[model samples]
Target: MEPIRAAIVGTGNIARIHADSLRGLGDGVRLVGAVDVDVDRLSAFCDRYDVPARHPDLTSLLEKEQPDLVHICTPPGTHHDLALACLEAGSNVLVEKPPALSLAEFDNLIEAERKHGAALATVFQHRFGTGAIRLRAMLDSGVLGRPLLAICHTTWFRNQAYFDVEWRGRWDTEGGGPTMGHGIHQMDLLCAILGDWTEVSAVARQQARRMDTEDLSMAHVSFAGGAAASVVNSMLSIREESYLRFDFERATVELTHLYGYGDDDWRITPAPEFADEVMGAWHSGASGVRSAHRAQFAEVLRSLRTGTPAPVTSTESRRTMQLVAGVYASAFTRSAVRPDELSTDSPFYRKMEGNGPRW
Candidate 1:
């Protein structure tokens, strides 16, 4: 099979991971080209990754290499236009998460993708991790039974220096606070595992940070199956202990990672009655950041070749974005908001209006 050709935009920290995945995969992928606004940094990234081709911007990159797919690793704010441009140019796109600043912008991107008949995927690669896989299997096999409750705690410290980047702390650029930024992966996985959420009520604050956006937030969500959940997201905590727990009628399943998503280091404690089943289902759910990212890349290749859909599609990503908007809406209204109630006319869905967070 021919290796899929890929070009990556944005040479920031995360892009290096994508580039390295392409490099380490050895034969499954081809690092065709790269694009970034910073010439020096772009050059350095290409040299480091051994990618021979580079473009100054998306336009030239599309016109030049015309890669089969473009990975939009740029900031969240840049996703809408970049994804549209690539799709219009007849290229598939795999954009990093928090797909767009607003739900409307995401709709625009989706429309463009459909009109152009292009493949569009969002990078929620944490869904492909070994731990995630095992958890999903348990949920599917009824070993955990119907979940009664769940909790996702994503607490990581981010100092002022971390948001020193011009676009880092702003709502117009980076989108939202810890909830949308740091906690999104776990939130996405929560929704992925437990099914859709019906309503959300949240409270947020800028406590302990100079950023204009909320550095801390707590949201209570109700899933379709009447399973309730609480998600606590923060960048103000002194110590970070990330965890996701699901309480099922038959058993309780818990997954914890020290830093965040894609961490294989996990622990699942089943209820005493279901202990045997849990033990029988146990597999080494070992993984690292690289492994999850690589699995998604390979899936992208399979989708391109077989015309099969990517595991994480744009619509699924939009639902995750809707959850993000719901968090903001719930915070602003001081009440619970249905996830689907945040439509095009909702205040939270208005793009380019919210002030970006400040350091």
Candidate 2:
């Protein structure tokens, strides 16, 4: 089989991880070219990965190399335009998380995907881990019964120096702060397990960081499956942890880890009557895989080969993004926000800070 020709745009930190993940795929994919405005960073990244061609920008890269897939590893503000361009150029796209700055921009990218007939996927790698997969499988099999409650918290520390980077914490650039940036991963995984979220009431505060976006956001979400989740995203914690807990009728499953998870990071406690069956299912299901870019890339490559929609499709990503928009909307407007409330006409749909944040 001919390898999928791949290219990386924006040769920065996350781009390096994307290149490494693609390289790890071996014969399934090939790194054909790379592009970045910074010549020094681009050159260094190309040399490290042994990438053969380096282009000055996305236009020239698309016109010249014509790669089969393009990875958008740029900042949050740049994702919508880059992904749209890649789709228009007849290439599949794997974009990093918080796919776009707002629901409007994300919808535009979805439209481009339909008009151009290319797959558009977001890099929500947390969903690809075996622990997540096993939990999902068990839930689907009815062993866990109905989900009741969940707690998704991403409390990590980022000193003032961390936001010193130009695009670190701004509404126009990085979108919102921890809620949109750091917590979206756990929130996405939360949505993955609980299914559709129906309503959300949230509050965002600048707190410590002196940026336009909030340093912390706390929300209460109601899912369509009758599950309620309390989500907290903060960049002010001295001790960091990414924790998620789900309470179901039969069992309670919890994942505690900073960045990624192994089997040991997950714990399951079942109700007395269903303990044996729940434990058996959890033990025998998916195992050994850690949540990382490589696991997701493997599935993306397989979907490409099979000509099916890729994982974390724009449709799937919209749910998570909607929850994000809901948070900001509820926070800014001082009321509970429903999924239907975030229409194209809504301010939150256009920008994460609806009608400008109060604080």
Candidate 3:
């Protein structure tokens, strides 16, 4: 089979991960081209990745390579337009998280995908991890019993200097703070495991940061599956950790890791009566894969090969994005936000801040 041709836009820090992950796929995919507005960075990235073609912009790259996939590693502000360009050109897109500045922008890309017969996938790598896979399997098979309560936290530090960059902290640029940007990864995984969320009530604070968006956000989310969760996305923690605890009727499954997790990062404690069944199910779960760009990329390539939508499909990611918007809506409005309320007519759908961030 011919290897799928892939290209990347935005030669920044995260773009390197996309390049490396694509390269790591070896014979399954080819790094055919690259694009960046910055000449120096483009030159460096292409040279480092040994990309065969380099273009000044998306149009040129699409016209030249016509890559099977384009990874949008640009900032949240540019994700919508760039991914739209790829989808319009009949190229699949694997975009970085917070996929768009608003649900409005994301739905635009979704519409373009339908119109163009292309796929739009968000880079929610955490969902592809072995532990997450195992847990979901058990949940589906009733091995884990009913999911009752949960906690998802992304607590990592970002000092004031981190937001000093021109686009780092603005609503129009980076969207909201930790909730939409940093913590969305874990939140995506949470959604993956718990299924669709129904409502969110939350609070956000600019806290210690001087940015226009919140530095800390806390939300209580209710899932349609009769499960409720407490979520915390913060850039204010000194001791960083990404922790999620899912308390099922039969067991409590906890995942503790910083950025990614190996199987060892997960721990399960089963109720005494269901001990054997829960332990057996957990032991038979997915293994040997860490949650990373590579793990998710492998699945993405497999889907493309099979002529199917990729792992983190537009629908799934949009639901997760809506959850992010829900957090912001609940915070800014001082009211609970539900999935149905975030429509095209809703201000929160057009901008995460709704009217504006209260802070």
Candidate 4:
């Protein structure tokens, strides 16, 4: 098979990870081009990755190289426009998380994808890990029994200097604080495991950070499958941890890690009566792969080659983004927000702050 022609936009920290993952794919993919408005960063990234072509901007790159896949590593606010442009250019897009600044923007991207007949995927790399994959399989197969409760926590410390980057804390740019930017990964993973959420009641606080968005947000989400989850997204914690726990009828599964997790990070404690069965299934399940960009990129490339929708498709991403919006809406309005409540007319649908954060 011919290599998928791929290019990277936005030569920042995350872009390097994308470039490295693409390069690691060996012959299955080709880094044909790269683009960034900053000439120096673009040149340096291209030099480091041995990219054959470099453009001053995305439009020039798309017009010239016509890559089959475009990795969007730009800021949250720019994702909508860049992704639409890439899809219009007949390229599949793999946008970094918080796929768009708002639910409306995400829906617009969804429309663009359908209109262009090209795939649009978001970078929710957490779902690609073997551990997550195995856990999901077990749940689906009834080995884990019914999920009754879950705790999704993404607590990481980002100093005030971290928000000094101009786009880090604003609603119009970075979107919401930890809820939209930091915790969306865990939240997406939670959705992947538990399925659709029905309602959310949340509270957001500016707390310690001197930023426009909240430094911390907490929500209680009810799922359609009779499962409930407590989610906490915070940037003010001193000792950071990304922790998730799911209590099932047969077992209690827990994952404790900071940024990412491997097989070792997972732990299962089955009920005494079902311990043997749960252990047997857990021991025989998928293992070895860790959560990272490379795992997700491999799947993305495979989907592209097979003419299938890629992982974390826009539709799936919209669900996760909707949960994020739900948290914000519930917090700001001081009421429980349901899935049906957030349409184009909803304030949270357009901007995460929802008519400016009350906090």
Q: How far does residue 83 in candidate 1 sit from its true spot (Å)?
A: 1.0
- Candidate 4: regions farther than 4 A off: none
TM-score of each: 0.93, 0.99, 0.99, 0.99
Please give the distance, in angstroms, between residue 163's alpha carbon in candidate 4 and its true position after superposition. 1.2
Clashing pairs in 2: none
**Candidate 1 per-residue C-alpha lDDT over 1-359 given as tens digits, one digit per residue, 9 for 90 to 100:** 88888999999999998887777677867888999999999999999988889899899999989888899998887988999999999899998887788888888888998899888898887788767777788778877788899999898888998877788767889888788778888888888888888999988887877766788889999999879999999997778877888888766667777543554466667778878877677653334443267778878888888988766888788888888888878887777899666776677877422222222
Count backbone overlaps in model 4.
0
> Each model's C-alpha lDDT?
0.81, 0.94, 0.93, 0.94
Can you tell me which runs of candidate 1 are displaced by over 4 Å? Answer: 259-264, 284-291, 352-359
TM for candidate 1 is 0.93
Off by over 4 Å in 3: none
Residue 298 of model 2 has an lDDT of: 92
Per-residue CA lDDT of model 4 for 1-359, tens digit only, reads 88999999999999999988888889989999998999999999999999999899899999999999999998888999999999998899999988998999999989889999999999999998989998999999998889999999999999999988889999989988999999999999999999999999999999998989999999999999999999999998999999999999999999999888999999999999999999998999988889999999999999998898999888899999999999999999999999999999998889988888787
> Residue 329 deviation, candidate 1, in Å?
0.2
Show the colliding residue pairs in model 1: 169-357, 170-356, 170-357, 171-356, 171-357, 212-358
Among all windows of ten consecutive residues in candidate 3, which has the lowest summed lDDT?
A: 280-289
